[model samples]
Target: MGFGAILDININHISTRLAYWLARNFDEKFDKLNVGKHQIKITSDTVYEVFGIPKGPKKVEIIADKRKVKKQEKI
Candidate 1:
């Protein structure tokens, strides 16, 4: 329905299949797989780890617009 929900669904689907394949075939060759904005790592032969911050969003600062103040006229 929403963008976030759709993105999450796709991520889960792809990651699940990728993890399965990696665990089955290349468990010893590679340690991690970069899928989109996520990093899936193989911790052990049967253990897989997923982190959303490996290449996901970063810290950001929002700046507010400054308004110029008018000078008062001299009396």
Candidate 2:
């Protein structure tokens, strides 16, 4: 794929997942939940009305990477 195509895919993936997470957890921001150079984060709230989670002991955390991927040049 082209550079623009890769970027578009990345943006779409993040936006889609973020929207779903927000809708389910009702949290505007996400919290980091793992050890790695990549700063992956997620919602801290457990109660998700959309998902029908009345009360949860733990919140959902989805790992994400927003770094731009280098496109391969044609030889």
Candidate 3:
């Protein structure tokens, strides 16, 4: 396999309990979760690997309007 990386997520169903636990133990400064015995790395890449991508139309925020409301000033 020439793939640069391989992900192995055994998530069969969602668990709110685990989510709450992780949230409580998560350290914002280090960006990791202290799972009582050890720490689990929680980076953006890891999150994407576990949850994959959203399956639906793109969600555009109101603030993300494409209208050119303000003209840019020339340097």
Name the lDDT value of residue 25 in candidate 3.
Answer: 93
Stretches > 4 Å off in candidate 2: 1-50, 67-75
The CA lDDT at 49 in model 1 is 23
* Clashing residue pairs for model 2: 31-42
Ranking, lDDT, top scorer first: 3, 1, 2
lDDT, candidate 3, at 37: 94
Model 3 score (lDDT): 0.61
Q: Report the C-alpha lDDT of model 3 over 1-75, residue by residue, as the tens digit.
A: 222233355544446666567678999999998977998887756655555643355665564565634433432
TM-score of each: 0.21, 0.19, 0.43
Best candidate (score: lDDT): 3
lDDT of 1 at 48: 16
Model 3, position 44: C-alpha lDDT score: 59
Taking every candidate in turn, the Cα RMSD to the unseen true structure, in Å, is 20.0, 14.9, 15.0
Tell me how many clashing residue pairs each candidate has.
0, 1, 0
Q: Pick the candidate with the highest TM-score.
A: 3
CA lDDT scores, all candidates in order: 0.45, 0.42, 0.61
